[model samples]
Target chain A: MDDQQKWRLELQNSNVEIRATAAENLCLAGSDSVAAAVDLVVACGDVEDVQNWAAAALEDIGAPPVDSVDALESLVSSSDPLVSYWAVTLLGRLGVDASRSQVILGKAVSDSPHPSVQERAAWALGKIGATEASVVESLKKAAASDSPRLANLASRALA
Target chain B: MFWLIVALLTGGGVSGLLNPDWPIVGPLVTSVKTQAIEYKNQNPLGLVGGDAGHESANTAGAYAGPPVQSASALGPNDKILMATFNIQVFGESKLRKPEAMAVIVEVIRKFDVIAIQEVRAKADDILPRLIAELNADGSRYDFIIGPRLGRSVSKEQYAFVYDTNRIELDSASVGTIGDPADLLHRAPFIARFRPRTTDPDRAFTFWLVNTHTDPDDVPEEVNALAQVFQVMQTARPDEDDVILLGDLNANEQQLGDIRKIPGVQWVVGGGVMTNTRQNKAYDNIIFCAPATQEFTGKWNVLNFEQEFNLSREEALRVSDHFPVWAEFDVWESSGAVH
Candidate 1:
């Protein structure tokens, strides 16, 4: 098997360390295959370390397959802050190409319990540069957030 | 039969003793070996500055501390400046840019000894190359690097680069604190140093624990670093001054349990932003104020954008984090006001 195939297999391994290592290797390898992206998204649910590497791998993959957007959008609602944070990070990296995630990204900005995830979602909205009324409304509400950092990022996104 | 199986399991059976390569455990053995190889690859200390006579002071074993010597009168106004900088992702890309390297080198030249973090590279020549650039003007500088560390494949190494003419390294006293519990993402690199002074007896000798805590795991890592500080305090029986400095990823108020350490004080206090963004305060230089009486009450974050007259874009290219520094008397203060 090629290296990507081997790493894809390792991503599904029961061992968290093995999965983490595989995600890391996949990132370093710079493989942007949809198959690898799917495997990494699945690995995101494993552990914090695994989620970090997997998120990094997705970001490194940059311009992931449009088909992968659904998986990423679904992950934004995850209860795990880190999981949703990484998911929003990758979506933001997708730029205007991830337009379909605008609604979910907006909801995450206003409704996500975690401030970090909300911050990233706001940043992602800015990257998306959406002018839709709903996105602007969510960012406006976030602009007055009690968290200064979050409010600042939301204001910037609106800008 | 039971005895034979137990012996085999314990590696005392005839076949196990003779071959030592039992097939049953081969997969587990291979995994262990792979992990070891990965660690060695990430470390790359053996490959650092190869054949260039670029020495990294990482000698093994515990330090016996400085020998007792006669006290001598310290010269007036003798002092040194020390700093900690997280030059975000210092690697080949950053090195190739002469403008950025010059800005970075200029920031480093401002201090006598600077602890650097985020030295991310598969190759080991980055630090040596940086030293070469710093000394292009005939300044004598050297560096000591710790093993690269991280939970991800994107590992980072910590380095203490010092101007040899202004500072002297205790060559035998360099190591990374052992973190067997996997608490810190990157264990702090530690070393001891004293000013290059005529009065060796009175030179202010101190240990520096350089670290960069994971931003995602700040609370736990900062808490664990408290233990690291406690360990370094006692690591050298003869040493009383231990200065822990690095990109802590948290401000003074958020330092967690480390702030609970008695007499612990930090240089880059609250309301100071260390990042180029001028937003978050994520770095500091901490020490026991009572023990390290050498501090001269002077410290500040070096804003390269303002100092170098670079635009915000230009500054960000140089580093996401700016250098934070503190000045100290060259001789042991011993509670002396001067």
Candidate 2:
């Protein structure tokens, strides 16, 4: 197997140290080996550190294939909420497309009851220029959510 | 021996059959008898063990969500079809071609008139190139790119596109009339079109405006829409059909604020993609007088993704949202256009 393949297998290794190290290295090479790395990390499933590292790598790749909407959408159904957040955050950062942003952001807002997840979705929607009225209302609601900090974030999003 | 068999049947065999404790008796009985309680008790979540990917799934009477989409209200009405999708600032880093274009194409396969929003500037950009590519690929469509002006730090707006012969756009402008600067979107696209139909009066004028409002200034988006009427009152002449299309961030419920200006009839927009989780109407095609009553049309959302069960990955690849298409037939009243 290739060196990258070896690293990916290492991610599933029982040792946390080995897995974390391997994930970081794969991220470093994402621009070169994105397809393999993306597949492996996503398949890694619930490993929080590994999934996040993979998201970071994909975000770094940044254009063309990175501009790929299917890749982001795949992460929407991710078992880990953090991984899903990372996907939405990265998609927002990449500016995937204004049209698709609404749908994906809509998913993030609806599916994720976690307040933090909702907060991230609200920000992404604003960045995406969400023309939808509900997004507008949700942003307004989120801006006023129970948490003081998130409320502040929500208010800013209203702007 | 017959007495021995009768004794076995009465005392031993009958008791074993009635209670059925195969585990204790077992080895011999399992081979002979089938419906064993012991077997049923063994794999209870298929709680019958071994093979994985089970559990939680055993919760049969659990909450199954609502039914998926019923069926598309827009199931093949006419031979010719047309659709418009403004992918919001094409040729930008954020735009995912796979997701956005897939959804847009899925919705707009047949429609003849497609008015786009936030097209690439005439300056050095790939958006114009992309438009050219679309034109080259399709036979039915020959795109007419119109007056360009910058909408924000990034986008220089685009408001028009069409098939060459079938719908001849006599003139296309950013604003309804006069200097383009008067209208927001640098001038909402005002196109004069002649629909080729059998009847003479059917040769009426139609106006299409594809626009994306200022996300920062909600008021600007609102005011820009209000100005659309001013264009109709003057530039479009006394009697003409006007159909304003685009991502009007304002909801249909709030559309009254926009319609208050005059001449605009606010015809069919209840069925547009609101982009919200809740089914609130957002995108629009507010119409002028004659176009308003143009046969009292259907206000469709054009969201085919719900009916066509594409996996989430595949659907997002089309676009974040489905294209919105509205259909209307022409009708005149009191010798004047409705």
Candidate 3:
């Protein structure tokens, strides 16, 4: 594969230091390695100690293309809190098509079992500026609930 | 008669032009006052209690039993609000974010302490404007800014604001809990607050930690969580308590690799919450000292979607996430600080 792929593989490999190096490199590798980026995140969630590289990899991927929205969406629905949390946030950072995305984002925010995933989805909706009725009501309920993070996301989104 | 009338008009016009006060002044002052009132009504500082339309209907503020029975009362009764939020930095360029920040502050006012993440450096408009407005409004938020670990130009990335009236901050700093450059972990922002000003140590002292973990973020999050827990476990007095909060980005479903971290307890009855567009919860607050019955703190996800002027069609126009809040006993003790 390409240098980007090579580095992405390194991020998913067994070596922690290599993974860190891969994260730094992937950040510079740009969009081609977006899969590697997502993979790194999923993989990092499983690593113990301090795998700062995984976070770096995801942040490096930054906003991805629309093609990957489905994959990200699937992860967003993950029962695993780690995968779900990062997926929601990444989709939020990358997914901005409010018209097409409102439903996708709405579903993720409303369905995720983890409050953080839900919170990030709500935030992504706000970031995309999805003022749809369903999104609003979901956010309203989350905000009114006992979760401060949800409340913050809801109020800010509406604001 | 025409000349005479012209002369009369000229005299009146000349006299009005020469004088500072004119017929327009009366109406102008009235308009200014009206505008001021309108501004205040819509202002976040004034409307924090959710005076907005439909959204207000669902807001706790709508039926709140006076959050404060006694503004400065004792322990169990003297509850204060503490919160943390990420004010998504207002885009790239821009140096002013008064309105953008007002959204956050208006919601933030109900709380006594707030820890903010992603507060962009001085170049960004939101942070400075936020500080200015809060200060101008006589806000007593004593500040402690977090460091910018990354190379990006964004200034102090993390920050803390605590109401001076409720807490006395002894010292604050950005901790490098798991600072390995390869791991891209931004240091955690920490501040110690004394609930009772008189005796700093004996009073309700707790650590308020604010952090934004790296997206598919570092293993550091687990380490950071563990370290904070350790600090609280060892340092905290039996009488005092610990409050830890931020966007953890991790949850129970995480594999044992992540779950192996020590002392980080998943808050019971606290799980990935829904009720938003994409239902999930990433943000969290963990208290380890067995939250005193007096300090039954939980999340307050403000459901602003149900309370705004925006309609169903325009709903997506607002933000995607919700603001999480919680009420806590600032001072845990009974006889003394309560």
Give all candidates' CA lDDT scores. 0.71, 0.46, 0.49
Assess candidate 1 and give its TM-score to the true structure.
0.59
What TM-score do all the candidates reach, one by one? 0.59, 0.46, 0.48
Error of 1 at A99 (Å): 23
Ranking by TM-score: 1, 3, 2
Query: Model 3, range B110-206, lDDT digits (tens) per residue?
Result: 5667777655333323344455556567654444454454422122366666555564443211233333222224556555454533333334556
Best by TM-score: 1
Q: Candidate 1, residues A1-159: lDDT per residue as tens digits?
A: 997899889888889778866766675555344457767766767764566556545644655666778888988898766568767877887788898788899999989988778877987887788677898899999999887657866887888
User: Which fraction of the native contacts appears in each prediction?
Assistant: 0.00, 0.00, 0.03
Task: Identify the runs in model 2 with alpha carbons over 4 angstroms from their true place.
Answer: A1-159, B1-84, B92-103, B121-138, B172-185, B198-201, B236-238, B262-264, B267-273, B276-280, B289-291, B330-334
lDDT of prediction 3: 0.49
Which TM-score value belongs to model 2? 0.46
Q: Give the distance in Å from residue B240's predicted Cα in candidate 1 to where it truly belongs.
A: 1.2
List the candidate numbers ranked by lDDT, top first. Answer: 1, 3, 2
DockQ of prediction 3: 0.03
**DockQ scores for all the models shown?**
0.04, 0.02, 0.03
